[model samples]
Target: MSMPPPNRTKSAHRSPALRPVGPNSLMADLDLPPPTNPHVQPVLDPIFDEPDDHGGPVDPVVLAAAMSNLNMLQKQRSNPHSASSSPVDSGPSSPNFQNGIPLAPPMSSGNSSSVPGTPHFGAQTELLKALDESTKVIRQNSKAPTRAPSVSGIGAVVEKPDYSEAKIVVAMVGLPARGKSYLSNKLMRYLRWLEYNVEVFNVGQLRRTKARHEQEAGKGKADHSAKFFSHSDPKANAAREQLAEESLEMLITWLKAEGGNVGIMDATNTTIERRDKIRQRVARDPNLQLLFLESVCTDPAVIAANVALKVQSGDPDYAGMSREEAERDFLSRIAQYERVYQSIEEPGISFCRIFNVGQRVFMNLIQGYLQSRIAFYLMNLHLKPRSIYLSRHGESIYNVEGKIGGDSDLSERGWQYARALPNLIKDNIGDGPLEVWTSTLQRTMQTGSFLPFEKKTWKSLDELDAGVCDGMTYEEIEEKYPEDFISRDEDKFNYRYRGGESYRDVVVRLEPVIMELERQENILIIGHQAILRCLYAYFLALPQDQLPYIKIPLHTLIKITPMAYGCDEKRYPLPIQAVDTHRPKPLRQRKNTLENTPILSAEPDELVFQSTTARDYFGHLPPLSVGTEQVQEDVSADTKLPTGGMIKTHGLGLAVEPGALKEALERGQETGELTPRAIAER
Candidate 1:
């Protein structure tokens, strides 16, 4: 299975210095036995004579073949020199030569008599000697018999020239709707045009085939609706897993047979586990090159539109849902996505993000494949950025509800966002090893469900706990515990709900998660609103007070580039119409179990410090007397506390406009606020 190293010799495209030599020209130069009995006349054809076709010189192929034949004759048989002690003057003795017409002389004779200065030789012997000398010079200047060059290279020696059987397998992965299929198709066509044998296996089709097979085998039975839509069913999950494994197996079979040069597997291989399986399968073949392509779309609206279109088109591979059904399907898929993202493990998988802009991205991928040596050269020179990208799951059902945190699945708009993500990535990111990370939450998972990257889920990335307030409306909380609500308003930062967690708690809980992130390279984290905020704040170096207030709007992707000094942040907001689902369900309605699901509690040690003192982290002044009641102040004189605590409370300046601040404060009240005692407790 091992392949020989590639030829490293330089190309020999330039013309040689000497004049063109024909096939027979080299034979003229070789010292062949001359005509023995004077019956044959020496041939006088010019070595540089042109061929009859187009008056051009002899073809290189023909000349090369002729030279090879001559070499074989020289090596396999005895020449005239082996049998004769004295060389005969085998030159043709025609009467025309006797006329004193000075022509090129015959080749040299071994006997001394034929040479000059021999005592027995007559006066005419001088002419014979001169002819012999001239013939010797002609023999020395002739071409040497050798093999013909198969390839065009100067001084390029191919140790193992046979590459006719080499094979490569490439896996094209990306978010769904990111054009994995499109890119796969384009690559197949291009490779075919290049005369390489290519076979493409689309996983979606395989799954359908497997589903039908299972039904026919009577191995399992299920209602059509259940078979098509159920996400939690064990049978469905098993069927899906089996489908993926079988598809890969089939691809391997194709590679072993007529795979020729390249084989591609196009699938929603969004989990590292799947990628690892492929890697393991291909690892047995040393000649096989495993390439990963990840397609991403940064624009949420575009993704949503594409998702809608796919649904409308009724593509068999894609889940063909009506507009309403598509939205529901998107939600269910998001839940599955969350599960996959949470399950990602170590060593990591490498993939390239291909934006679905069109053929440009596909062409770039192909170029990378064909010119990998050049790319490696550039990479060694540090010409490109080593990047890792993370995106939040597209907007989910709970996200639209203005709820702090929940596992509610992504809505229709969310599906659109997911669909567009691939194209955005393709258009913007080019290509390379890319891995995706998401929390084990429905919303985050759904957002990434469409992507084609190897996805891993970290349970640690789950949303912040709302505790006993999990499914409660804001009004319900205010009515049930008015005093507690007021106290929370007084101190939002350190205010932990009776059963839920404080922002500080979230920070402490995420410590291990952050450490893992540091160890990874080029990871994209798709998580919840609050969880993302906490992580984003940590990267941006925002103070504790601002962490909870960070505005992570639905359908917006925030990119944090962590650097030596700090992290750079950029936001790509989806332009889809916001579905206003923020209003809490009526109190009389029974809350959905999925929304009220409880998560594992943090380890006791994860709590870290029981209390943290507020240290004017946001640079805000102390409260000022308002009508002698000493109401909490918004902005007053900048103050300096002991222990290097400086509070530049100039009302948040330009970065935090007055209107934004007011809005933030209103949101803070809706959630909870930090009182003086709470700050001291934190």
Candidate 2:
């Protein structure tokens, strides 16, 4: 995710062409209503297919309808000269174009509507033409490539263009525990996960480090409470001002460094003067874009939750203190900042205010790709600590058939897992107003159906688009499109399926889901493998290369509880039969007979722990209610292997000895030190 090379054109501030039109202006004359025909719904469904668990091909009738709609839009462009001509052209140089500025033609005389009573075809066509024009304008303004390379066939793997010269400094603004730290860390992690070179310059961390150094030198303990943050207190104000200056100096230096793309300044940049100081300093760099992100929360419950989490999981100042004392100290810190806290309303400054997390969002002057991306990501975040349960939908009929992508119904074993899911959730999460989220697929919905929790679906949560190979198995893909299969194996992350999505595309679309998840409390996401992979990679902070390869097997429930340092993850396997659809590409399989493939040696119903902490699986962990005591009982009960089906961990291949595996499982259940959360928080 590198920036595009610097543009020689006028800077963003001076360029009127770069000025974005208001949303109303863009949508003013373009509103295409949905198709009223019931027949169109099925066809439209295929356009947004998920994984094999929830995707199918477009019917020919729907394809014909789409083609007809496209033809209608093309009708107005049939006469290119007419489209180029001014709508009100009485002469070659009419008043509409007197100064060479073209104006939109007047609507057909006295016709109140752009389209007549036949709204479907006419209205859609006009709207499409208008949208096309707008798209062209936007593309012209953006100097970078307007689109990815042509992926007409299933095999073309296009290289994503970079944005080389773009630099951004996202300054955090809000009172203590208003989600500033969480938002900053989350944003930084997300961007870095996208392979962007991003770093956070936390002013609080700087101030704390400085204070610690002074204390080590026998100086008095630093008062890092809210009092030190007040703008009215001269001495405290001077200390804060000095700390901010030092942090900004470091940020600017990093921005000018070789690989820095974005530097997030994390602090309570509350007052107008403080924010302006940041804006003015960064304003000197014509190439650098400064964006102020304000996390404003008023809800008492949300605030209290944030404060509690801060006391328990955040704030180094709270160390060695009791929860009561910590909470009081943190509350006092918030009160001090509230005294001088001024909401960001500086005229002409590029800023975004996120109200109570995702409840509402407002932005001004936020332009460019990087800035807009940051703003979009922030709109999806809520600072509250919560648990997100992620699981791949139960095995589909296609899994038994060895297909890659299709909207197939669940297999018998899949239904078994689905039925067992509720018990698993109950045992692990205890009680909560759990919300179920699934891709708009029948299989995922079916997998989550037995759960009494309210369910919502997201189109973006669907699996990676296999395009022309939607219903085909990996074997079929190799036979039909060997080059594409090989290309996908070579660089799976960047390999975009012909007219389908790459892992990168999946990541981009999943940004909203991630943001929404950040705001949610207790959510169980029942989605496809690829979608789950993206979500899992985000919370656990896996590298980009590992994302596409991270195996998300069926019948497993993954719980992620985000904390201050890193998240705590637990994988619980339901006691149900399911097929192993995971196809790991081994080095030996490349350009040779696909023989001697590693076999799954684990049990069909038993959980396979990765190289991650054994405690992450069996021991007591935060956010997850399950403990080693229960895990020991379950492990002892299910030690027997089921028939001949093997459960193989991919990377370990045949290296895992049966005796060693049993020994590790037994050892994991033994009593250990305090919970992983305690160790991590410490």
Instruction: State the displacement of the C-alpha of residue 379, model 2, in Å, after optimal TM-score superposition.
Output: 3.9
lDDT of 2 by residue, 67-175 (tens): 2443353353232212111123323375633343223222233332111111211124432233233223332333223244563236554454344566888898877
| Candidate lDDT values, in order | 0.43, 0.58
Weakest lDDT window of 10 consecutive positions for candidate 2 = 613-622
Candidate number achieving the greatest TM-score relative to the actual structure: 2
Q: Could you estimate the TM-score for every candidate?
A: 0.30, 0.59
Q: What is the C-alpha lDDT profile of model 1 across 192-245, one tens digit per residue?
A: 422356767776655444444555666553233323423345444444445566
Candidate 2: which stretches are off by over 4 Å?
1-154, 190-196, 210-239, 299-339, 358-362, 368-373, 383-387, 425-442, 445-459, 468-486, 512-523, 561-567, 583-682
lDDT of 1 at 200: 71
Clash numbers, per candidate? 54, 12
For model 2, give the RMSD to the true fold: 23.8
